[model samples]
Target: MSASTAVEKVNLREALLTRRRARTPAERESAAEAIALHAAALPALARATRVAAYLSLPSEPGTGPLLAWLAGRDVPVLVPVGRADRSMDWVEHTAGAVESGPLGVPEPSGRPLGPGALATCGIALVPALAVDHAGNRLGRGAGYYDRALADFPGVVCALVHDDELLPHVPHEPHDRPVDLVLTPAGVFRPSRDRDV
Candidate 1:
């Protein structure tokens, strides 16, 4: 990472942390709506056969509507189940098949599916606190998604509200860049200028 990029990321991280602490319930609700609108507009979502999406936590990007749409279309939907090392495994889930897990996140009640299961998915909707124009994602500082997405060779998209798509995010070498950014406005192909 360049020195300027590093400084920019630090500022973004601080801003995001402050924003998360200050967000009201209404703001969160609006953010969820934004996510839904953007996700619904993405044509790649309709073409995906298998999709790996995150199970939303209270403050995270909401996936309920998107998951429901995918299930209605008979597309295979999977949610991540966090492992011991902050890595994750995808598991199939449907409208009535999810149950609250130990961590309070919704997960599939059936057997855990493997990472290889995402091999056929044309798109994967990843959750992020913030993302940059270059696609560097700022998660909650846990490297789970970063590690989990390491092998996904297909389109990896980050879901965030328009405001969350900030100018920069605190990123390290291990952090992965998303191929696309899905915001309430539309889908964007992040600039490749910052590629490592």
Candidate 2:
């Protein structure tokens, strides 16, 4: 990473940590609003026939409004269910029909989807603790998303607060970068090249 990028990363990391420490219920609510507004700006999301999204946890970005909006649009939404080894399994969800899974993340009450089923999705909305300009994503330090997202063949975006958009994030060659970063402010292209 460039020196400037490294510095930015440090600053962003600090900002996120500070915010996380001081986060209030009202702040989370505000962040949720921002996420909805920014997600609405993505035309691909509306046009997508199938989408993958995560169930929100405390301190993570919220998906309630986004999921509700997508349901209103009659979009097929999928949420991740944790597996035995900390990997993810996707399941379809309909409005007012979600259930709590092992990790307390909301999931579809219907049958769970296998890994092969996720390959056909047109969009994947990932959850993240932080993301960088290069598309590098820092999740909750788990490899679930990194592994599950490998087969996704469409637009992959990470939902995060504006403060979570870091200038750089630690990554390995095996890590996957999201195509876009969706925040309340707007949708940002993490990298010009989509291949990353």
Candidate 3:
């Protein structure tokens, strides 16, 4: 990443996070419901034998409803646990115990299935600050998801607000673009399909 591009990503992330924090609780709740509906109906998600997902922070679009919907169908869901080395581990979402990870992100308290466990899942629903029509996603700058999805073969999707689906987002060559984007409005493929 160029120095300018790195700065741009930082600024974009701050602005997006601020906007998210400004949302009313009711607005967030409604958006979450809509996003759940949009995502749960995806053919790829419907066919997944296993899923890799995240537990959204309060300010981000809620994934609780969608996770619940998946659980209802008996889909085995794995949520990420961030490690000190900035890598991620997958743990089954048992909906039992919960604890914060190294990054302060909520993680399933179950035994980790290791990073390679992600390969077993058919699709991954990842978090993003914003994404472009080309599928370039602006994450929170931790490089956790970027590294995790770098060589991932399955479908990788991002969940963002309707407005966060931008016409473009500054991206680096190493940035892993998403194959699909899920928003409150609907689920969308990038302007062009990206090879998995």
Candidate 4:
């Protein structure tokens, strides 16, 4: 990435984070519920054989509701455990069996299924600060998800607030674009003909 692009990304990330932090707890909860409803009804999700998802941070769109919904449907959910090399190991999501991992995100207490575990998943629900109509997602700049999903063949989806669905965001070649963006309002396909 160019120096100018890097600087722009830094500024944009901070602005988005500020907006997210300004939201009320109730607003966040309501959005989460709406997002869950929309995600649960996704056609791709209904056909998924396995799913990869993240445990959202307090500032990000909460995944707890959707996670619960998936569990209720008997969907096997794989959550990420960040590794030292910035890649992620997938583990089965087990409620109440989580502890903070290397990245300070909640991780499943079970043994990791390894990074290649994502190969078995049909879809991945990821956290994003903002995403453009083209599916370019703006994350926390850690490059964790970007690296993890670099070679993933499944449909990659990003979860964000309704307003975070933007017209554009700074991105680089290493920044993996999502196939779908799920916000509180609805789901958007960045590419109409994108193969699920």
Stronger candidate by lDDT (1 vs 4): 4
TM-score of decoy 2: 0.85
lDDT digits (tens) for residues 99-173 of candidate 1: 787667777777877767767677888888888988888876667788877888778899877778877676888
Q: Assess each prediction's global lDDT (C-alpha) against the native.
A: 0.76, 0.78, 0.91, 0.91
Off by over 4 Å in 1: 1-14, 193-196
Q: Against the true structure, candidate 3 has what lDDT?
A: 0.91
Arranged by lDDT, best first: 3, 4, 2, 1
Error of 4 at 146 (Å): 1.3
**Clashing residue pairs, candidate 3?**
none
Error of 1 at 37 (Å): 3.0
| Clash totals for all candidate models | 0, 1, 0, 0
lDDT of 1 at 21: 68
lDDT of 3 by residue, 162-189 (tens): 9999998999988899999999999889
Candidate 2 residue lDDT tens string, 1-196: 4577556556766667677768887888788878887787787787788888876776777888888888888888887778888877777877667778776766677787786667777888988879889889876556888898876788889988887887868776667889998887788897657742
lDDT for model 1: 0.76
Model 2, stretches more than 4 Å misplaced?
1-18
- In angstroms, give how far residue 11 of model 4 lies from its true place: 0.3
Q: Write out the backbone clash pairs for model 2.
A: 34-184
The C-alpha TM-scores of every prediction are: 0.83, 0.85, 0.97, 0.97
Q: What does candidate 1 score on TM?
A: 0.83
Global lDDT of model 4: 0.91
Judge candidate 2 at residue 131 and give its lDDT: 85
